[model samples]
Target: MSIPPGESAPNVSTGELNARYDKFVVDLLGVIAYGELSAFERLSSDARYSPTLHDRAALGRMAVTEFEHFDVVRARLAEMNMDVELAMRPFQPSIDSFHDRTRPADWYESLMKAYVVDAISGDFYRAISEFLDQKTREVINAVQTNDESGALLQDRLKKMLADDPRLASRLALWGRRLVGEALTQAQRVGTEHSFLRGLMIEDELPAARNEVSTLLAQLTKNHSRRMSQLGLTA
Candidate 1:
């Protein structure tokens, strides 16, 4: 069932807990944990396509970073008395669908995918974290930070764009396609997962609908800014 806009998370007392909201939190953690794990796999495979030893090493480092983030989330799940792997299982279909549909065509495409997709995912997570408790929010924020790969990808793309201005249009199109597929899969997850959809409904009052609208605007703005930073048209 879905909550109306602006309804506070269900309250429980004494021996009771808000099971629905707690489940939502667990599901969020699961999605992110599995996302990181999948990222590790994808990045590792992408490294095999790197043109130079240096580039491959850089991708390898980024893969390790992804696994490290996955471990952190797994630890958090353990603290919550949840089965980490089981919790992550429900999220795999959507996350995997996103990655499978958007697999990069080459080394440059992989770099663009890493930068654009990661930034978009990060912004989306940051927006959702606002609805969570302080501890959970902190965990999500820490997991969402873009790492050295972001910087390396930005620099590489900038140089490439500078050297061949025509490449910008193609990469820009790829970025747009990435965002489109991501949104498609995101909508599927939201529809299939009631608790996740509930998180967006800030309260029961009709006026609270603005919260979701505001959130969408914020995500879009952050995305446009990142695209600009990468010297691409959003």
Candidate 2:
């Protein structure tokens, strides 16, 4: 794909560029693609939990978006002379574990999990891409990485939490459960892929770890505030 002038392309000849691209870009894209592919499968199944036609359609749309993301990553992998499935193979178990462990019980829970996924992935990708060459960065940016479904979910969930205060407790508890599952999968991935796990985001290994920890802390705080704001017991 043609990127605009000045876009950073992968300079494979430059060892530093190649290292950054491989460590951060590859990892981020692979994870993004893996997540989308799994979401495509799981969200299709999860849509059944929607209690209304609109809610069902909303969930269905998320699946569609996930497929689009999968296509984007698949194409990128091809351009890099990598087989998408082979590249994704190593990550499958971790991704599968995450979705399997956090099977949503209801419409709200589904939305809550979606929100968490969106926020965390966005935070990670946006940080990881900063060090890439212009071409590589542009290509990554060109892909649809934003969590639009999460926005829709947030709007719906916020209103629901407002209407039914008790739902705040239920949803916050549900959010924690989803995050816990994701952490479990993350730990599994890190343990399994020592080299990949050491790759830093924002050019700092310590910072990335801090970002992950800090983000989790923030999510927890947000959940608590949301629960309290809705007058629900946490």
Name the runs in model 2 displaced over 4 angstroms.
1-24, 142-148, 187-191, 194-234
TM-score of each: 0.86, 0.73
Each model's lDDT: 0.77, 0.64
102 in model 1: Cα distance from truth in Å? 0.7
- For residue 89, give model 1's deviation from the true position in Å: 1.1
State the displacement of the C-alpha of residue 204, model 1, in Å, after optimal TM-score superposition.
1.9
lDDT of 1 by residue, 140-224 (tens): 8778746666888889789878988988888989988987777666557655775354343334434434555565577667767
Among these predictions, the greatest lDDT belongs to: 1
